[model samples]
Target: MHLKIGEVSTIVVSSPEVAKEVLQTNDLNFADRPHQLGADIMCYGSTDIATSPYGGYWKQLRKICTIELLGATRVRSFQSIREEEVSKLITYISANTGSSINLSNKVAAMTSSITSRASFGVKYKDQDAFISLMRKLVTLAEGFIIMDLFPSQKWLHIISGMKPKLEKMHKQFDMIFENIIAEVEKTGGEVETESLLSVLLNIKDHQDLGFPLTMNNIKAVILDMFVAGSETTSAVIDWTMSEILKNPRVMIKAQEEVRKVFGSKGYSDETSLEDLKYLKAVIKETLRLHPPTPLLLPRECRETCDLKGYTIPVGTKVIVNAWAIGRDPEYWSEPEKFVPERFIDHPIDYKGFNMEYIPFGAGRRSCPGISFALPSIELCLAQLLYYYNWDLPSGGIMENIQMTEALGSSSRRASNLILVPISHNHV
Candidate 1:
């Protein structure tokens, strides 16, 4: 469907076939990210991977992302970090056993800490403030304000007060990054291993890439990792848990699978994560239903192209509604239901192929942090189900759990999920 919103030509793709045509068939034609006001200010000229216009520079950055930054090796190197944090979450839940606890906050903090330690080899002194700042930035970065819709109206930004808000947020963001970078530099590589920041700093100092890396580039890349890794991963895990709690049968089956696979050993680890087949299926179904970004980051057309007989002119903004496509009845049987069994032996994966299930999106601009995120998500969920039998807080019913989608570009739950935990007998 085509929409003309304040001079911006917008095209929305809500069908699997159309999504494929746009994301894969003519991937190059829509390789560039649309210039949005939030990215322009927050990402320092939109130099980050998600906002960068498609070009040789973008390609170079992507290459580094896939091979060095978020490669198999780099993701694997963070295993211990994931284990420690997830274990802490489990311990916290256990300590508060029987009383109501805020699972949403606990999970978010756990994931953010893991992302921070993996990035800087340490956690921030004011971690809570940092998380709050990230939440605000993500909401703004969705670009829903009037200023974004009418980009040509430069003076309108000031009148609406959007410019000042973004400018203030950007300074807070920079100050945080500056302090962290300075701390990392003072260490002088004294740490035994290189953090993600260290890797970027190393590459920048040596001018090791075809495209030079500026300080802004480094900061922007790190921001991308947090938004993708910490925010998205935590939200997915939260949704998966909510779904499981609402469906007792799913909860039982998932727990059995996690326990049976990691049982006797009483632990979750890289070696055992693959064996939790049903658990993996649970995650797939969750993503299918609650993709963090219902509509993925927009792509700008680089050339005129024919999309399933529709003429898409150059410069039109393209948005693939993963939420709608994932729920299309034509592609999925009982699409609205949370049935992990449907995916138990299913060949469908979310890695862009089979556009019907693109949780992380498809094609050239798909999220590159999947390798960096899935482990934390899988590990946290698997452990939560493995060690405890969860219960709704006193008098709370499964059906009443707030499954309402919160407003914003991010599809988070409107309410914090509260639950009671009971230790399980592994034997």
Candidate 2:
């Protein structure tokens, strides 16, 4: 469909066929990331995987992501961390039995802690500082900066005063990242721990791949893992909790299934996690309704490509609205409702494909953290439901739950998901 945002004429590709063309068939013609002054400065001039232009360098970085960091073997190695965190969540909920709990905040903290530990080997003792900083940066990045829309409007940064704010944020981020890098370096490179940063530092030492990994590149990668991995995973858990709470029957059934399968496990472990298939379905359904990143990061056309009858010009910014596509009436029945049963026997999965379910995106440029994210979300949701019966605080009803979307580089729950948890007898 045609869309007019201000003076620009844009086409919105809500159809799966068109989405396929832009994301897969003519994928190369649409793999570039839209340039942003703030993003460039934050990512150390597009050195990160998410913003880097498609080329040999990007390919190499993507390889490092897939084969080393987010690869199946490496992701599996973090199972212990996930299990330990989920256990902590369960314990916290149990302790707060009768009081209202902000599940979103807790989940966000859990994911961020896990990501920090896994990626940087540092877990923030006071997570709020990090979370606040990230939220601020996300807001700055998502807003419409004049520089992004009109590359020629270079003076607007000064006139609008966005330059100073952007510079301040950049400095703050650099200090945080550099501090972590320095601490890692202090470990003397012989630590038995195998965190992502340690691996990257090792590769940097070898420097056999032509371009050596600079401090800027290392910082960008660390930022990507922290921001991209943390917020989205936390948001997914929040949505899952909200949906299940809204539908108490579904919540009960899911909880029962988890408790039944894990019975005497004492804690939610990797073994028990594999058996919570119904809970997994709940997470998939949540992603369907509330894609953390409502609009997948904008992709720029690399070359001219024909879609339907129109020629998509090279360098044109293309955005795949996974949010709308996931809820398209033609694809999902009662698209707005939260229903995990929809996946009972359905083969559609989020490892891309199933255009109607492109939560993690599709094809070559799809999110590399898909494996890490799903398990983390699944385990957290399962543990929460298995151990507690949730209700809104102070006579709060499902309607009272805030469904407002937080505006940022990604979509998230506008309000912290606060609920009272009652200890489950079965567990």
Task: Report lDDT per candidate.
Answer: 0.88, 0.79
Which portions of model 1 show Cα errors greater than 4 Å? none
Q: State model 1's lDDT.
A: 0.88
Candidate 2 worst ten-residue window by lDDT: 2-11
How would you encode candidate 1's per-residue C-alpha lDDT over 1-427 as one tens digit per residue?
A: 9999987899999999989888998899988988877888888888888888899888988887898789888888888888989889988987898899999999999999999888888777767888999888877766577866887888888788888898899999899989887877787766535688888888898865766799999899888888998999999999999999889889999988888888878776667999889999999999999998999999999988888888888999999999999899998999999999989888998788989999999999999998899999999998888889887877688866779988878889888988998888751
- State the displacement of the C-alpha of residue 250, model 1, in Å, after optimal TM-score superposition: 0.4
Per-residue error for 81 in candidate 2, Å, reads 1.6
Off by over 4 Å in 2: 2-9, 189-192
The lDDT, on a scale of 0 to 1, for candidate 2 is 0.79
**Predictions: Cα RMSD each:** 1.3, 1.9
Residue 332 lDDT (model 2):
89
The clash numbers for all candidates, in the given order, read 0, 1
- Give the C-alpha miss distance for residue 368 in model 1, angstroms: 0.8
